[model samples]
Target chain A: MSIPGIRDRKIEDVGLQAGVDRLTEDQIQKTIKKVLKGETGAKLKLYAETCMRCGLCAEGCHYYMSHDKDPSYAPVSKVRQTMWEILRHNGKVSPEFIYGCAQIAYTECNMCKRCAHYCPLGIDIGYIISVVRRICHKLGVVPLYIQDTAHSHSATMNQMWVKDDEWPDALQWQEDEARDEIPNLRIPLEVEGADIFYSVIGPEPKFRTQLIYQAAVLMNETGQSWTMPATPGWDNSDMAMYTGDYEVMGRIKRAHFDTAMRLKVKRIVMGECGHAFRSIYDMGNRWLGWKMHPVRVMHAIEFYHELLEKGQLKIAKTFDTPVTLHDPCNIIRGRGLMDQAREVVKAFCPNFVEMTPNREHNYCCCAGGGVINCGPPFKNVRVEGNKVKAEQLIRTGVPVVIAPCHNCHGGLEDIIHAYKTGQELKFLIDIIYECMEKPDAVE
Target chain B: MNAAYEFVVGPLAWIAGAIFVLGSIYRLVSMYALAVKKDYSSLPYMDLKYSLRSIIHWLNPFGTAGWKASPWTAAVTFIFHICLIITPLFLLGHAVLLETFHGIEWPTISDGLADGLTMLVIAGCIFFIIRRATVDKLKYITSGMDWFVIFLVLATFLTGFAAYHQWLNYQFILILHILAGEAMLASIPFTRLSHMIFWVFIRGYMGSEFGKVRHAKDW
Candidate 1:
């Protein structure tokens, strides 16, 4: 029932102790209390008291079903570990308990909020867990690797430590690279008042710069009025979502919005990222006390759908494969965009297999909500824990898995690789790039 | 020892003690059986890693991790719960009843701890109510059931304190407080308070699931 490639490496054994050197119990307690007293703490209190324990959330959770019908792995149990225990004990539990709470709050759960979809009562266990993370961040119990990313986010406004001077250079690099495939391709940087404010996570600049290159080629072919940011706010990836550091999470979001506002763009068009979308819409913006976002946000899938539907982008060829889509919890469950993503998929791929309980009910990639970002020590558990997801994919027997969110893409890469399911994970744009009928071919 | 002639004391004592024991046993039995049927699994080894992280988590209790998760909310909410728990079992009335019935007069906390725990319960309830009102994300999630639970707790705490302090001679307040206490205990087997007994198992189960994912036993 498990994937062969999944390694049993324990994240704790992998130098997590190095991050443990600086922290002390008193400092962690102080940090935990501070976060609880802040806006995030208040949110946790509200979510905890509201859950009626209806167990409707069971079906929405992959872990719950993945473990052969264990009711405890249900998403609600995830909240119970952190919030309910804190509620029952009056904050007097030992540090060992807090550690368990930290892992459950941050790594084990993906904060996809799909369970909220299944709940008639609309209980958001993901929000409850994020609040737990907010508390954990304050306590300094966060895994060191993930914490470093947050530090990078705070310092560079990107998670991957991409240097300031390197951003525009990278964009130029991608544009130059893209010209090999499309001679007229360009990656527009800092074009004020452009119709689209194109944003991406630090991974784009750091590791998968080719995605940027691909986007540039697509944008060039479509002649889209897109602009990339030259400044610190260019990164749409918010590590605050993972750290549970709501205050920092809020600041990052405000920075992102202010950056967009300064540019006077109509709306932000983000690359494939689920958690970033959630941070902007669900966790961060709400922490800032806004009922709704003033500036609109669009996922890459929805944005591509608009472009294709409006004749802004043209297809080169129909992707001929039995490709299954892994709905990023942020986009599908958090934002309710299952149909649009499917529509975009149908337009490109000739054969699409829908996973059971597809769309908004899709399971998290086990890498989101900062879980994958939590570091390599906990990687084995994350991979092993996603047996249900692997099974879901295996049952579908699809050769390709398209995950539009960056975290999902990263996490899925690990999951698919670990399971050795021979499944190729991809961003929807990759398919669009391959399947879109060339302009010359159409002529 | 002189129980044969004293009908009210001996027979009623036996009845109350029996109900207390049998009812609690029944509740525990039913919960355990339900849990067994549902197959509440054990935590895996990865949970141990999480537990190990607690060494560092406890290092900075004031930071986010220490205070963010359950036991904190549970701590406050349960402070109220613990007060409700201790007060009912060790109150002057309960002491007198137990002395007459079960023949056990438990040593009590200082009057200060008693009153402090009560005030603590009140503060916890107030904190919960205010949080529901103020936080926008929380406000959307709050239900009428939540409000009812809050108000019910306030009534129980306020009335019990009033009776305990002798500020209310209105047998009404004392009687209502007693009824609420009894009702709450009975409801424990059915309502959300059941989470008190079940969350440990649930959390342990959740903790273990990660191990299966990690390909190790739960921490």
Candidate 2:
């Protein structure tokens, strides 16, 4: 049942409701205070005092634009509704308020960091929302699906429930599939000292096995020294960071870094996953009180660009389709790989068109930052809230859009399908694989 | 000078100065200590190059994505902040007062230029009011205190302009202008106006995160 009008479409979420039911008033209040006093420092204090509520960040937010310029959807207003809400209540958090926070933080925001960039003061509303999610996580009032994924990160060390044996099996299956084309390809697993420890998100093994297959083919054709671990830490992607389970988040990062260290690899090369790269490079490292990665890390965009630069990965055919590039927020805005990604696209896709606000200035797919992991209940809200993105894609006037990140593909696919823009999305690798020269395959 | 004028011009000035300087220093030191205590990792990435780059870009009008997003706000904000900061320091009247009171003097702007800057600040404040009233985002985010802060700033410039022009009761307006300026100074470390001091730290932290950690330009 939707509790509309009073609280603005408070949809029933079992995870949130159950989590709230399990908590007492005392527990909720104490949890909030604990997180506030222990976890936060001057950054929170400065943001709180410095915010003039100027609302200039509103124009940069897709949710604000898509929501018919609704005042509440403004980035600062979202902060007011969640973080400021907690402050106003002074830690006496109610079930209903916590519910609103979970929805707004987990579903309403993609945490794209666009608003942070758009803020004249460089105030990170995404970081503010993460603190809210952190409080909600402690209160045990998290949205169900993402919390489930976080639990998967906790228990199995992977987001999917793939067991000990399934990881290597999935890699083997992808290798066998790729071997059909390359005829001498191998997805080497658990090599002791490969230069690149190629890691990926959980979805690859469960369903998007083709991404793994293509990455393996790229590795094989380039004659690269890379390996996929058979162990639990092979999944570099994490949902725990989004779920606000910092302990689990820290553990996940540790496991990933340790796996690479144990394998004695020179670097950890991640698949086309933005959030995972963010986890390893930016967010997760800081959680462990470190400024640099334990091992060097590379995203697929950088890896491919390196290969192309070295003439290792040769382009066999230029893609004929009129393609446009969707710069994912994590890599482009968060990590700054816009020029490299565009270079790779220019190398392969001859008929490439640029979006209006290309590179770091591009809008986020509503499905990122674990908003998509919040699951089917909030899909409409996610789809409806990114009309600006749909319009952005449509304005490119290209049938094929290339997204180099996994979460971007997930979010853009939904937006395209919902808007029925008749646009198709592909990974940069998909086009790269289609157009690049393979070892032994003939057209 | 009359008693009321003397009090504002004498003891009140010293009190406001003491509070502004001491309070701002206290806030800065306390904030730094807090960061070191709980967020030590955040401090490690405080790259001077990145922080300077970020601060310089933000200080430039329309240099940031946020500024360029709405050119009108950027224009008003840059004009307002620049005039608000400049007119007080560079005005011939201020320079004369410093020379008279403390045997200190610096380069000063001509009265005509000072008049223009003061007017720009007042106009910028009016522009902000209209924006808050019209724009839904600004309207929702703004509170009663926010409105008061803007009006407080506006009053300082308006009274100074009125005093300079001798619009009505020159002595009273001049005293009012001095008091308003004092109040704004005192409010800096106490209210939303504290952004003046916090901007350095915040910009530096964000720059470090983007440039040193994420290898991106925040601007």
Best by DockQ: 2
Instruction: Write model 2 residue lDDT over B11-30, tens digit each, in one string.
Output: 99999999999999999999
- Lowest-lDDT window of 10 residues in candidate 1 chain A? A1-10
Query: What would the per-residue lDDT of candidate 2 be over residues A1-443, giving only the tens digit for each residue?
Result: 11222167787889999988887767778888899899888888788778988888888889988989888888898888778767766678677778888888899888898887788887888989999999989888888899899999999999998888998888888878777788888988889899999999999999999999989889988899988788989988889999889899999999999899889999999989999988998889888867778799999999999999999999989998899999888998888899999999999988999997888789999889999999988888889999999999999899999998888899999999989989988998898888898867633
For A1-443, candidate 1 gives per-residue lDDT tens digits of 11111112223522234433555656555655555543342224434643654444665666666666454567766665567666655554455556666766766777765564344233447657766776666666777778888888777778898999999999888777766667666677778898888888889888888788777767777778888888888888888667866667777888888888888899998888887887776556666766446578888888998988898777767888799999877777556677888999998887999986576556678888788887777787678778878878888988999888888877778888888889998889888877765552222
User: What TM value does model 2 have?
Assistant: 0.97
Off by over 4 Å in 1: A1-33, A40-59, A69-72, A117-121, A438-443, B1-219
A-chain TM-score in candidate 1?
0.90
> What does the interface RMSD come to for each candidate?
17.1, 1.3
- Which whole-number lDDT from 0 to 100 does residue A221 have in model 1? 74
**Lowest summed lDDT window (length 10), candidate 2 chain B:** B136-145
Q: Which numbered prediction scores highest in lDDT against the true structure?
A: 2
* TM-scores vs. true structure, each candidate: 0.65, 0.97
CA shift of A384, model 1, Å:
0.7
